[model samples]
Target: MSFCKSSRQQAILDAASELIATIDLEQRLLYLNPSARQLLVLPHDLDLEKERLTVKDLHAPAVYRKLDTEIFAGLLEGKGRWEGELEFRDSNDQPIPMQMTIILHTDEEGRPLWITGIGRDLRRRRRLETQRRLAKRAFDHAIEGLIVTDGRARIQHVNPAFVEITGYTAEEVVGKTPRLLRSDHHDQAFYDAMWQSIADKDRWQGEVWNRRKNGSVYLQWLTITCVRDVQGRIENYVSIFHDLSEMQAKEEEIQHLVHHDPLTGLGNRHLLSERLQHGIRQAKGQEEKLALLIVDLGHIQLINDSLGHTNCDRLIRMQSAKLKAKVQEADTLVRIGADEFALLVEDYSSLHDISQLANELKEVLQEEIDLTEHRVTLSPSIGVAFFPQDAETPDQLLINAQAALLEAKKAGRDTFRFFDQEMSQEARERLKLEQALRSAIKGGGLSLSFQPKVLLESGHVYGAEALLRWCHPELGPLSPGVFIPLAEESGLIVDIGSWVLRQTCKSLVSWREAGLSLPRIAVNISVQQLEQEEFPDWLEELLHEYDLDISLLELEITETGLMKNELKALMSLARLKERGFRIALDDFGTGYSSLSYLRKLPLSTLKIDRSFILDMGDDPVSLSIVKTIIQLAQNLSLDLVAEGVEDSCQAQQLFDMGCPHAQGYYFYKPLIEDDFIQLLAASSS
Candidate 1:
């Protein structure tokens, strides 16, 4: 009986050793009795002495995929135990499921010791055995649907988000292809492309319409990606999707805000440019024509000032509405800038169409807008340029339109001009001349000639009116008519004006030195100089520095300048006149102004513009207008000066008309100061 007991005990111990050696959990043996390496398939690189080894000795298990590294680390760092799920794989590539239990091994009295992990492989359990107790959690709680498929996009798994989004339950979706959910919004080519992406192991993200279980269609942002095996073969396709109708709407709203003007809801500068370029290409390809018409508000600034920005805005909005009404359905009309707008009229071959539209646009603005007790009217200035004739590019078209617009402004607003070949040549020459002018100012190539402003009764030279003359080194003496306007446009007029003022003062001092007794010299001030912010102070400084009597310096202003900026111009003239300087209104009667307004202005003289004088000998209307101007000047107690009096007939008309002073080509052409002084000597002698 004793011998039998000993043999039985040995057999029991042997069986226990075999179990310990064979059971697996992915750690070094560390002197385990047996079988751990065989079960875990521990690599040779793993040492028996190692305290820790990765579960990677096999494929990491599904449970390990869900393990939170942070939580496991926290447990191991402080509590001396970590419990988590770890997925694994065997040598044959079968997925291995695992539950890992890491516990602290301690000695007596609870002293800290080694960390020992005990693992249970659950490859046979499919993680459902644990889930029956724990229940579906993360996979079911996600907000966006998570859909999985085989390499062919056949349905494999669906989450609660997926079922909720698609209105399909897991039981209904598991085996059916994802195509069952397709809304048919996309063609077969789309799905073919998606499948090709899966086979290529790529990803695609875009909006797709999907039908619900009840056959209702809804848009969703779908992201489909392929999972590849080690050999780079497509193993699975995973798609995450969210509904996209609301998002797309918000995106479209942003795009509209970017491309359209909010106030008029017109295509803005950006959209205008884009359309113009497209139109250019179309025209070129079809051998067709397009016209760019630039419409400028002639009196927007004045309206904005008098009626306030509120009414101004309302006016512009109304104008835009009218513009939309006026343009063709296929054309694009844009309020491109404040006070500036544009229209792209395609297939235009003649000027009459553009001219008619220009007329209609202007007529639309003729309606009066009531502002409290007052009413104001506005008109437009239009500039037109035809494609292939004016320009080939959008930018060039814009410049051409601008050039024409400038001409309209010169034509006195409420007018239209077409781009002509002559305009381009003229612009180029003006640019060249402007450059030469700048150089002339710096190089002292500009000279001042003088003409006598005679007192008609005595024929005595009051003083020589300084006239601008440019002696282009190669081009000979260039007329101010050729380059003065160019100078004014380029903002070089201010410098030229300064030179004239200084030279006139120098000439007056020279006349005094020469012992020639003459009246005060008059200097022509352009509308720009009148608008100068520092005109009064500048005049004071110029006068005081010249140490000349203010009476000896006369400042002439145009009727347009005086009429347009009445109050400001009056203040400026008043300030100068207060200091004893003579103020003469140049080109009088050229502009229409209320007699009350004209009478209210402080004036020393009126220089009637040449237009009224050109036909004074034969035109009764012209003669009547001239006589009325002289009478008006007399009524205002202001002197009258008639310009462009080229003959005895006109001079006699002015004399008979009681015009007090006359200056013209007939009296003496504009001459140098020396020639003028000699003429004055002859007159005096």
Candidate 2:
């Protein structure tokens, strides 16, 4: 509750990753940490305190007014803080984009004393947006010629390329008839046949010689289609054509050598790369999207290792045919490697469309393929990268797509992954951590921290949740958010989960033996742990090994974990509960758990997730949700505990709402074993 800044507080602020600035009650700048100064790019000679700038000076006029009206007003009304994307101006009068979070610091007497602002620079995000705009311009002015005319054949609209290609500007061609470009190269009977085809089918396409404004004849591959009104009558004539005279012979030679894969007859890597670059440029120009999919046939090497190269080649040919049949002509499929292929898909509508095609590719490969003298089946691991979204360059796009494909393969084959920047980073980090965690779990470097769950009404310690924390000697303290998922993904959670259970039970026994009056301890249970068939038996063995009472332990499982295999999870919980182990559904109200379904589970407590409780102060919808959840817990005859009760107001609100138990920084953060035991002893005293 102290608004005063100590040296330790200043140190913490200075070390923070985000820019931090503190303003006093009069709104004058009180402190600017190194990060804040760096973000503002303040000159060395300019002393922040000496210059005496106010908080309002840091922001643009309109932004300051809006923040004062909305954010400050809400803070004055007792809301804790406000956070949003805003522009902060530096001393040079240039706007710096920031993701800003500001908090109003108040004294114990509830008088506002300080306002602290933390901002993260958004230059990278802005640069990406600017790139998209530039790409869009390139797409719009691309080299394809397009012309639209009235049903009477009078030219109505033409792009800039049309003027450049045909030697006629829009001013001269706007109202001209198509007859203006007619060439004597096509006889009267040929014109009649073309018009007859258009009349019959509403479309005509072929190579035709046309004269430009300067009287030079050029060959163009022209496609013209009749556009119809809603009533189905012809409204306009649309024409798309590109000059193909000089490049025709050159394209044929290039196509034969560079484009085709001799083995599968699909496009090769060179052609795929060219198409990817062209597709990206086109996507940028049209403000559309193209997707590059890298498909690796899983277990193909194993097939080659077993059935020889001839059989493997046959399998590759079979998959190529299956995949090619599914793709449209506008899309390009290329064989990039012996077992890997790439697809350059243009005009994709959304991520959903790309995923659907990836799934179809996976499905097609999964089907049985006949090889001479052997019947074989293969599965595909697919990775998709989007143009002008994932990367700007062709190489980066392909690399990212291949990274996603590697991720899919790592996550067990026959699946597909879409390229995301953070996911790739995390996947790489996860691989490193997986190896480290295997050592950490076995090398006795892992430990536990306990946060007491207190009674909301009386502020008495009711129980504690055992949280797992890791400190790698080399990597330093790793967050549970980082390592926990790695454990789950690498199938290391089962072993780690066992270690936590045994260690927590041993800690509880030691606490009781030392004469501390501690209540039950809750440990998180992962889906992998719960799904283990011998989990209940192992729990019993750990309880016996520690010589601890089963009633002293509680198991916390997430709502999503329970829903993963409802029947199996229910059975596991039932068996554990029968052995005097309490079951608490942690992070309640975050997942799709039904009240009717809750009635069937053998759960004893429902712990509200922190996110919902965080907004209970100002968000009416959150308040209603918490209230409904509390009511539902009561109806189900289950004890309710709210997580993240960071302030007295949230605690008092939950208590008044008839929710009895809570845990968060309002009372304590998770502590080491010695500190936790001391806390319990102090609480008892």
Candidate 3:
């Protein structure tokens, strides 16, 4: 029985995967099993009895002190067995951590006999424990909400981020499924597809609408991954999600800004194109006509000068609101340019209806708009183009509509015109002319012609009017009647007028240097030029630069131009008159002949319009109108000049009518600078 027990003990020791050793009471090594020799890096052939090694030799001094002072001291103090951690040194003096059990054997009197130790290597277990602690910390502090569910889809774990995102405590959500957070925004089919993807590919990711614990729906970007065990069976599902509600809201706001005008909240050019294309498609399907009307508010610059830009913008917004009220919900209204709005009319029956609509729009805008300081009327010119008749494409339609608009403005503002082939040709010519004119202005291709203004009674020259003349390299001389309106419409009149003023000043300086005396050089100014608040100061500075007196320059303004913005025009002219500059009201009796406002004007001269002068010989009404104008100018104490004295009969009629001055072919049609200088020399001689 004893032999069997010993054999059993030996077999157990040999089969152990740990270090097994026994030592005597003197601390000398007695026996070591195969496992103990391998663990201590000792040779299997070593004879422990021949070369006795003590337990202290296998341990560092500090370790042995610890074992003796703490572990062994406890065991010797009537503790039959002890189990704890300990360290031993290998052959290379490297420490090996061990989880150890020590047993003490004694006789009946309880005296110590020998010690037996069994230890297991703890390096791998310690490394695994450290990795687990780090992973848990990362899971707890991650920014994205994390969730872990068992194979049955029951919630098993949730991170703090998950709790915060869902507005739920871990205690309340530990065993609930993800369905608890469903917003019901998606039908069963959506969830079915999601699960199908997960079951097939072991992962799924997409946007999802979910409800928080507070019962509010929120959008999130969710990614779910399946976790498998060693046997390749589903163990858990790990999900990561980030809230996207705020981000989606920002994206929508950006889209709105991209498609809308900031000042008027109307659809911009981009939205116009989109809606126009869609409208065209619908119109084509239904075989109906659609009208694209481009409404241009004329005299915006005049209004802008009257009201400051802030008030001007307010007026624009108000006008846009009124325009919006006139369009159907199916139709689109867009602000495509400053002072320009476009309306897309759908489901129109006939051209007459489109015309009526355009007329209605014009009338709507013509109604005076109230500003902070002024009530002003808007002269709206509308251009209409029909789908399939004018153009088939969006770009072509827009181009055609704009061409028609230019024609409407040309015919006169406060009107509307339909697209036609002739208008298209005219638009192209106008564009070419505008480009060439800009080049001419830059390259010194423009020059001035002087039309001598003579005294009707003496036949002596008083002064000359400086007329702007442009001779294009290819198109030759262009009529002022044609290009002048073009320049005014294109807003190039301001720059051109400035150039003309400077050129006239230079001419006057040259004539003065040559000892040729002229009373003043008359320069015609447009309404656009007069609308400038800085014109008075700028003109004064130009004169000072040339060392010329302000009286040597006569600024001629048409009655029509003056009435456009009476307040601004009066202010500008009053400033000039104060500086001793000559202010002549040209084309008298032609426009807004309100003697009330006319008397209020500060004027030095009034020129009778050529139309009445040309007809005075044949038409009694024309002759009477001219006589009345002469009397009006004389009564107003304003000097008189008769324009377009073509024959001696007209000149004799003007002289007989007591008209003081006359200018026309009868004196000299328009002379060049050198020729006009010769004329001035002759008159002086």
Candidate 4:
């Protein structure tokens, strides 16, 4: 009958999922639930209706002792309840862990009657708790910043990376809004749009600028995801972000290299073209003037040859610095080539504004620059082309500016020129002439002529000046005045001048070999040739080749040529004089004629320019200049030669002025070699 009662109680307890049992004071089980049977893996053959069960039957001896000491001992003392984890053995002898909650059941007399206990299987909950701890570790230790916010968008927690990235401790940021990190780079509207996107799409990701605890701004790639509950209600917001400032800076650096010159850090050609086109469009819209200037450094290669490549590069950098410092911040400076740079100017008041800027650039280039041991100055030729006037496109503007630059160079260094239609025509003609001159120099279209210099007293030939003449196949008899400057400007003067010397020396040898007595012939040398480091040595070789007397060779360099590189000219002339070759200062009174130069130069004669001689009888000032030049030559003990004495009056005046020699059409026009030989023979007779 008692077993039946226990069976009824156990049947009622079967509804509970936990293991439930009733135990007597002796620790014998009076009733146990189906959950308890399954938890212990009891044999189906042992029926609770037939056999008795004890706690010692299920629990290990150690577990029983712990139960007796901590849980059951307290329950036996009439305590209300006792709860702890305990171990029990299953039928397979494997240990099962259970969380036990036991209550002391007693009669009205306050004596313990039985222990009512419930055991929950701890394995599943233990597995879940372990997983939770692992997830917490990952969240706290992640490298990317992590933030957890409540549904109200208030910060609840932050990862260690968040604290590190923001320089904010958890104490400072918890319960605060994300506004603490806002850099104010974005307005409320931006935030509103971002939130709206997140609300509609459940997530938003982009680059954001935020402030750190130290008030420094940084860029970061941020992603915010909305977490929802099972009912689709917002539960939390999780944000993950990483700093992107370094990567962004690297990208900007790469972009900068694409549009800037590597050497000078100025704009390159590609960027210049881009900016020019944009400038044009803007100017057209505003109805404003835009000026494009192409600046070419004249004789840059000459500087390079003289100063070496390293110093030349330093000179170029200095020029760039000057240009940048002088131009307005709005203007664009571009290094387009080795010796060529371009400028795009806007916000100008008028054409005069651009012109003034151009002049300023020229002035900047004129300043003396000291590079290491060398002191140098640059002469920049600037060409200006206007918008809607000279050209409408970038290409056309650049071409027009370059054409005008050629005109500026032709006008001489340290100048600026504006574009016009005439310059285009002139440029084309100049190119054709340059090509033809090159051909004439290479082919045998060039020859020499001898103009007699006569004694002013006897009217007899003393010596002749060798003149260069060219007869182009297409344009016959191009004069020396027209082609000589071209040769000098084109750098062909060195080669042409050398050839002239060789030819003159050969002529003298032939004359001597044929038994014809000839005076010393003078050859005009250009500034380019005079500045050659090897000129003195080259002249010695020529003198040895012909086995001619060095005293019979005279070299005439213009006063302007000597002043161009005074030291070089001084050294070269001194060397020539030491070797018995006579040197004449040509075109006297046409250049800077300092008494110091007259005293220092190794000159044998001073040749009066043709301009003074042509105007001597016509202009009183010219006559006075001639008289003064003769007196100056006399004082210096230098022989004087009056050029262009075309009339008897001019020759008589030159003779009265104490000039020793005169050369002009009045004596004889320049003659070919055969005619010159005949003249020489007659003069000898």
TM-score of each: 0.50, 0.44, 0.63, 0.54
**Per-residue lDDT for 454-564 in model 2, tens only?**
987688898999999999888899899888877875679999999998898888888878888868888999977876669999999888887887778889998877675
How would you encode candidate 4's per-residue C-alpha lDDT over 1-685 as one tens digit per residue?
3568868765678777898988888888887777888788876355665687888888888888888787888877767798889888987889888898999998998888998889999889888999999989989888889999999989999999999999999999999998889997998988999999999999999989999999999999999999999999999999999988778899999879988888799999999999988998998899877888998876677677667788888888889998899888888999998888999988688888888889999998888889979888788899988888888888888888988998898788799999999987776777788889888878877899999999989998989999999998888999888888778877889999988999898899899888899687989988788687799888998889889778887889888877766766787788878877888888888886756778898889889999999988779998898899899999988888998989898898888879989999988899999999999898778
Clashes of each: 17, 2, 0, 0
Report lDDT per candidate: 0.75, 0.85, 0.89, 0.87
- Residues 1-685, candidate 1: write the lDDT tens digits: 3558878855564355231221122233344322334445555354545544443344454444443354334444567566776555554666545576766555686654444555566655765766754645656786778888887767889988888777889998787788788787889998888767755658888878898888888899889887889998888888889877668899999888877888889888888899899999999999989899898877675566545678888788878887789989889888788878899999975778888988888777666766556677776788888898899999989888877877887888788898887776766676677888899999999888777777777666666567888898778888777787687667788888888898888777777777777666778887566656587788778767878677788788777655555655676677777777788877776677736646666678778888889987778998898888888888888877888878888877788778878888888888976787787677667
Candidate with more favorable, higher TM-score: 3 or 4: 3
Could you say which candidate leads in lDDT?
A: 3
Leading candidate by TM-score = 3
Clashing pairs in 4: none
Model 4 global lDDT (CA atoms, 0 to 1): 0.87
lDDT of 3 at 489: 72
